[model samples]
Target: MNTAPHSLRPLGCLKAGLRQARQQRALLCRQMATTTSSTISSSSQTAPDHGFYKITDPKTQRLRSAFAVYSPSAIATSPSALAPLIQPSTSSNPSGALARLIVSPASPDPLPALHQVQIKRMDPTGARTALFAKTRHAARVGDVLMVTHRRGGEPFAGVCISIRRAGIDTAILLRNHMGKVGVEMWYKIYNKNVAGIEIVKRRAKRARRARLTYMRQAKHDMGSVSDIVFAWKKTRKVMTTRGGGGGGQRLVVVLRRRRRRGSRSREMREGVGERRGRGEGGVDGNRLCSCYLFC
Candidate 1:
């Protein structure tokens, strides 16, 4: 037997001790991190993982989830009340209905000052005699329209900032910005002074205000990409299991009272002779007794 002093232990023992110490230290650190993380997660409110704060209303003390402030019920019906908001207001009876027309040059070749093309009216009503014919689809505010001048020159293209559809003197307020300067021109559809008018782009389905003067003042047309990302985070759905099998169904089983194990074994032991009489085991009483003992 080779005996070594505790101080002069084998290299393997020293390695094992160091390994155990390291494992203990690692476990202690993991426990501390887990406790800290749990504390953070248990807080009442934390910033979302997507990195955006929830907007709260100061008055209502509720989250502001919508982009617009006005609700359906709060919409003002009076034109005077909505004038300050720069929203468009039309009369109860509109004048000659608005329509779109293809205002191209009369000639094929493009000129330096003026481009010549034939004009084609795209009104739903088949009326070529009148310039302002009643049509099912009328041009409204926020619609992009192209207006050709009387000299068959380049068309004046802009978005309809406003529309005044009051009787025979109906007119449209077209706004076109040149560099930093903004230019607005009002045109009567029935006037022979204007060559033609064509509807280029329709307004968005989600447009709130009829007069989109607010758009000119806005820095951006739509919300930021971060807003969209944060929106999805705000509207997460609850998780659920999906299947067409018995796995989703929960069943409750009721079990009847069972005989006591000891009582059952004793009964089997006493009935061993009766079982032998019935010729169950062929002349093996000891085997039958052992089986009854384990019953």
Candidate 2:
């Protein structure tokens, strides 16, 4: 009973369709507006957050910025922006440079030294005498020294002693113009130019020194018992053998072995030329003699 006419139904359907189309169009318009707003927001710049970047006042008008993000690969960046990122070996570095590595080299110290040394020994005879050093400044063994003596308290000349050793004080000496070393033959001038005992002791005390051997030799004269004896035996031997003309020739050989000192007693002072008795045998300034035994 209430059903519409067939023609009216078609007209209602059309109205309903029109209303749905209007609602769809309105919804589409709202969607387009939202999309446009989103697009604009995405394209524009936003305010920086404290986590992303830092701001700095370089100086007057100069301002700078840097990124705080820590990523291994992110370090390959611009110089000004990346400078603050570098770290130093110590915590004190505010600028953050690599820091210098300083070091030093090594060295050595120093020492002291010496002057001269003697190789051989020389006769102590001339040593005390200033003449000793003067004669042989740098004396070596085998050197010769003139021998002298006193005859009847008179100065006699002789040439004896050849150097054997070279030392600071004592040295080995041979007598008789190149004789072999023997007791009297190898006599040592403990102090050449040797002075009397009293004088030596006095000088030593005056100088407040240990020894006056040097002082004595310097002032006193030198003579040896060996020189006298050697000459003594030589002269006598000449008298007995060559008689008078024997002076020009060297003395006869001395059988330095110990023999009888006198014809009567078996006394002795028989040195090198034991062949004859003590009269003239050694190299002392005065020398031993065979005269008493022979005559």
Candidate 3:
């Protein structure tokens, strides 16, 4: 009975040792898992610095810090990797590095940016804005306007009937009379072919509507404005001359000679010998006569 108890004591000691070994192994595995998870979380929270950093050597115990130089092949192959390293542009000039990058030769699509630049160049003075503004001085419907074409043609003077406010494509409709016939035309305000626009006359009274399409009818029609245009031109003929006495300026009457409409025989007779001599008609027969009036 003594020998049997001693043999069972050895078996119990072996079972306790096995349980302790299993518990130690589980604790070691849990510690390793926690260490790995902490490393992963720290790496994810911190952002990598693309700038210079110090590198410490384990063997020599030396520290080195310098700018990192990348090869052209690496830059070409992995542009996204190096994108964060490039700094944003700070210059205000249009010919700066960023501007050159956007307008680079490598770009296949640059028409949209180029078109916006062209639109800005087309209206540099903001004259189109003033002409279509809602202010008291701005042009309105029923106001007489004269538009001159760069390409040779008679200037068109008409009343503004409608205005379309489309960006880069703004246009105005004008109606006028020619030889007892009503004529209407559309003029693009920012067109390259339009030389200039002049306000010939303002409306005596404001119109009741935005568009004056009712003026097209015979009953509401405004007759030919040619007489008013001629009167305006006559008023613009007064000239100013500076005096040498006190540096004061005086108004002068500029008399313009009118060509006589007569028979061919009469024109031939007047051109024969009368034009060669500077008689009472002045130095050049067609020269303007200035009559100075002291102010």
Error of 3 at 24 (Å): 51
Each model's lDDT:
0.42, 0.31, 0.58
Off by over 4 Å in 3: 1-119, 239-295
Candidate 2 — what's its lDDT?
0.31
Each model's TM-score? 0.29, 0.16, 0.44
Q: Write the per-residue lDDT of candidate 3 for residues 1-295, one digit (tens) a residue.
A: 6799998998999888876675565444333332133443342223212234656546744443353222222333455433422432355343343353454344235565665566678867766656666876677788887778888699888889988876667788888899999999899877878777766777877888888999899998887878866765553332122233532222111111112334454554454325323323543532222221111
The alpha-carbon deviation from the true structure for residue 158 of candidate 2, after best TM-score superposition, in angstroms, is 6.0
Q: After superposition, how far is residue 2 of candidate 3 from its true place, in Å?
A: 99
**Residue-level lDDT tens digits of model 2 in 198-235:** 10000111123222223224243233334544555455
Q: Please identify which of the two predictions, 2 or 3, would achieve the higher TM-score against the true structure.
A: 3
Kindly report which residue stretches of model 2 are placed more than 4 angstroms away from their true locations once superposed.
1-144, 148-169, 177-184, 192-295
Model 1 CA deviation exceeding 4 Å by range: 1-136, 218-295
Please write out the lDDT profile of model 1 over residues 45-159, one tens digit for every residue. Answer: 2322221356666895544433222221122244433432232123211121111011212333333222111122222232221323333245556666666667666666677
Candidate maximizing TM-score: 3
Q: 1 or 2, which is superior by TM-score? A: 1
Q: Residue 236, candidate 1: how far off, in angstroms?
A: 44
